[model samples]
Target: MDTIIQPVARPSKRGSYRRHSDEFKRAVVAQSLLPDASVSRIARQHNLNANQVFAWRKLFGEGQQESGNNVCTLLPVTVVASVMAQPVAEQAPACGGIIELTVGKARLRLEGAVDTAVLHLVLQRLLP
Candidate 1:
């Protein structure tokens, strides 16, 4: 795919400022981000400086995170059975759990059903 890309904005003679379209930047950065891809090689193919491609990659990554596209929403999980305590001869099985976390002087203890999403948000704020 060596299609010709017309310059969005560049001095007719010679200069430092060369404005490129966001589409071009995104395309170049996407190519550069592929696994085991060489930034220098990709830049050379697009007739761009490696540093500029790297900068574009950084810009795109920041944009995605800001747009929540790069934000981690949650993890995949499956529930097979309820976690139950051992039952005795004349008693029914009890389902419960305990989770304890300490942050400096603050102590948190959760019993029974635990929402992983809530815990994840809490930890994201609590931990480094």
Candidate 2:
């Protein structure tokens, strides 16, 4: 008995080809953020399918927060990075040797003059 082999079908350039660079991919993902900008427009501009652009958008959106957090940790750089990354809006004005920071409407009071050592202890307890 003889067995027949079938050739694999290739994607057609007219309906299948999609080209994207690192810069283009980032731009497309960013531009696709607006509710009005259809995925097709972004993908077409970058020679990509609507589905491809949509996927990129989703991946990048989900990753943005994690990437920002990594910058805060900066384990490979400096330990101070984590402290410095504290969001300013969450911090309350220091008064009478006390400082307050809010986390989701829950008040985190840092009492007394917050020296580096004390701050470190507080961070260890609060963050860890």
Candidate 3:
């Protein structure tokens, strides 16, 4: 009895490389910055290489810095009050109090009512 053998498949002579637009790259980088986002997972979802995404972030960041658009923007924050068994009168402060803040390696003690303008100026000088 004679057996038939199948020929092996040959690879293509040319390799295909995809080019992504700047807008698309920026979008992917922004997505990767979202809270709880994983770079590898995002790249997989977008059919991109994790390294490519990281490179895009670096490149985009450099561009932003050069254009003076690297200033930090404040994100919206939420404050949640916890319920207590005790009454509010007992827990409430009698008057304005002092608070301690740790900014970078420096510690600041702000007592009584804090001036928003002063605090803003101090923070602007303290932070990067």
Candidate 4:
């Protein structure tokens, strides 16, 4: 008995390219910004790359900041005096007290009073 050989099939040459609408990208970016949301998980659910979502978020955030919509602004801070058993002069130290600052995901512990210029520089470096 003679056996017939079949020709092998070849893959398609055209590549698949998907285009997403700005509205869709905005919605996905918004979803990714939700508290406790996972970018990888969201991307997987939407059949998108995590990096793409991150890029969209960065672009959206920059636009908002440029428009002064999501710009970071300082609010009035109130400091209250704590009552102590010892006299104020005796209890007070030569240097100022410690200050804890939470900037983004960074936690900074600074002992004594920080200089205005130094603090400004530190914050500028710490922030994006």
Candidate 5:
């Protein structure tokens, strides 16, 4: 019996493609978060992309205070106060007048004519 052998696939072609060390990732994240340090500049200096540094920072940030002392207890009250402070928008004044229709020299006018039938006919003519 004859057996066939297949070649093993090689790793990525991007030159060894080593992941940055934890310490290096931390340093990059720290520098990117500094008061004046821009993420794009920091990423350029570290040979990385802006998105990569941002992802690391987000992954390592605090979710909530470990002490658990109600950090957001006032959120509901603050939201309610903001909603109550706004004034309602004023409505537009109604214009009540006779409707007029003129086709070539002919003219038709009606006061307070019911619109349902006319609207239906107009819509049916306009649509397929």
Candidate 6:
């Protein structure tokens, strides 16, 4: 007896990007969160042509700080000023700026003159 083989699947095309209101996203995500829910079926019921329901579900779940063993904390960050290096200057001037990061009751403040390279590196590592 001969067995039939399934063809390989190619990468699916991503549809156009469109912004949806927070209420709409929340509603869709809420429906998708139900037990035994199907994202495709939900999207179809909503009449959305894009394949962004899964993305929306993830986006709405951004507040979740747990991932099995590790606990990821979401911090609040505020940059009062931004500094950039001068390509021509041998030494960059001390651009004093306040960078405040707050998570719950914890707060981190970087005041006074801060190094541009260091600040850039710190932000790169900290932010998503």
For each candidate, how many residue pairs have backbone atoms clashing (under 3 Å)? 0, 0, 0, 0, 0, 0
Point out where model 5 deviates above 4 Å. 1-12, 62-128
Q: Candidate 1: where are CA atoms >4 Å away?
A: 1-13, 62-128
Evaluate model 6: give its lDDT.
Answer: 0.69
| CA shift of 119, model 6, Å | 35
lDDT of 6 by residue, 1-128 (tens): 99999998998999887777888887887777777988788999888743687787677573442333355556645565555656745755555656677544555678877776887897666554
lDDT of 5: 0.60
Q: Which one is best on lDDT?
A: 4
Output the number of the TM-score-best candidate.
3
Model 4, which residues run further than 4 Å from truth? 1-6, 14-16, 62-68, 71-128
Q: Write the per-residue lDDT of candidate 2 for residues 1-128, one digit (tens) a residue.
A: 99999998998667564565767777777777756877788778766778887687676663453333343432222232223444555665544554555533345666654566777886676552
lDDT of 3 by residue, 45-90 (tens): 9999999998998987833532223466453443434445556445
> What TM-score fits each model?
0.38, 0.37, 0.44, 0.40, 0.37, 0.35
How do these models rank on TM-score, best leading?
3, 4, 1, 2, 5, 6
Q: Model 4, range 40-99, lDDT digits (tens) per residue?
A: 999999999999999998987723523334567563444545645665346545366666
Is candidate 3 or 5 superior in lDDT?
A: 3
Q: Which residues of candidate 3, in runs, are more than 4 Å off?
A: 1-4, 13-15, 62-128
At residue 109, give the lDDT of candidate 2.
Answer: 68
Instruction: Identify the superior model by TM-score, candidate 1 or candidate 3.
Output: 3
> Lowest lDDT 10-mer window, candidate 4?
62-71
Better of 2 and 6 by TM-score: 2
lDDT of each: 0.72, 0.62, 0.73, 0.74, 0.60, 0.69
Cα lDDT tens digits, model 5, 1-128, are 99889998888667776688877877777777777889999989878889988888886562332233433332111121222222324423323545454433545555643464685685455333
